[model samples]
Target: MKPFTESMLNQCRKYMFNFFDYLPTKYQASARDWQVRKFVWAFKDGKCAVSAAQLVAKKIREQFGTSASDMVFVCIPASSQRKNEIRYREFSEEVARLSGAVNGYSHITVEGERLAIHESKSGKHVNDVQVINFDKEFFKDKKVLVFDDVITRGYSYARFACHLESFGASVIGGMFLAKTLFV
Candidate 1:
């Protein structure tokens, strides 16, 4: 894990872990790791692959241990509610269960349709496009772990962390399936 420096400095501390290296657009015949590319594509297309989620959960368990009950795990909301349901809902449940963390997947949510950040050059900030939902006291004085399929600019996790901090939550870090070429 490393400091998520893409986030604004002095925000509640945030660290991040990435399970795999990714380009997202690497399609060369000899680019290597076709499985990685396929897994990312499947996730983007709203296919929740339990095998990949299990792999991520294993890494989290190795790091945080089965005693992560104190940490609340959350995922960056999808572009819309339906996409979220199709992708992250089951993915998060399995990760949290296998990682021994509190399931906070549904705690944060999106308002409506929005352009995916990576699909655009000058994309909207994550917080601007998504409305969040959480219990007023759910995050109070708790450690939060943000989950995402990939970490590009880290804006989503960073913005979500700030929101969690606003409710007195301490962002322990983030867990991601992969990392893009840039941080």
Candidate 2:
């Protein structure tokens, strides 16, 4: 896993952990990279996604000593109801289940509609505040590990950490499948 520590517009110095770099569409010229991107985009299929989730689960177990029984895994809410339906399951929830951690999907919810950020060509086009609604009470004093498919500007995860901390939850860290470098 790769460590991320950088400051964004709204977020100060924060750290994020990612499994791999997501090759930008423009730079995915290699067959292997393209296939990996495809697999990430098509995670709803459950085969490759499940396998990748297992790997992430292993990393979580190794890095965070909190037994699976005590850990709560939360997925950044899906961008749209349609996407949620298509995916059939939230990637983070599945990873938690396979890894033996408690699923925390009900803790974080998406309240409003917003365009899928990744669908935009540029990261600046999307606003995360309009999309995510956090349940402050649900995470009180819990050890949480937040998960997302891909992170671009780190806005969503930063806000997640902030909210969790404010509500008295100890944010273990963020885990993502891939990260897009902001240039």
Q: What is the C-alpha RMSD of each candidate to the true structure, in Å?
A: 4.4, 5.0
Q: Using Cα atoms with residue i matched to residue i, what is each candidate's TM-score against the true structure?
A: 0.82, 0.75
List model 2 lDDT by residue over 54-171, tens digit each.
8778887777655766878877666664555345355566678777788786655555557665555455565544456667788898988777778876777876676777788877
Which residue ranges in model 1 land beyond 4 Å of their true spot? 1-7, 10-13, 26-33, 122-129
Candidate closest to the true structure, highest TM-score: 1
What is candidate 1's local distance difference test score? 0.74
Q: In lDDT terms, which candidate is top?
A: 1
Candidate 1's TM-score reads 0.82
Which ten-residue region of model 1 has the weakest summed lDDT? 5-14
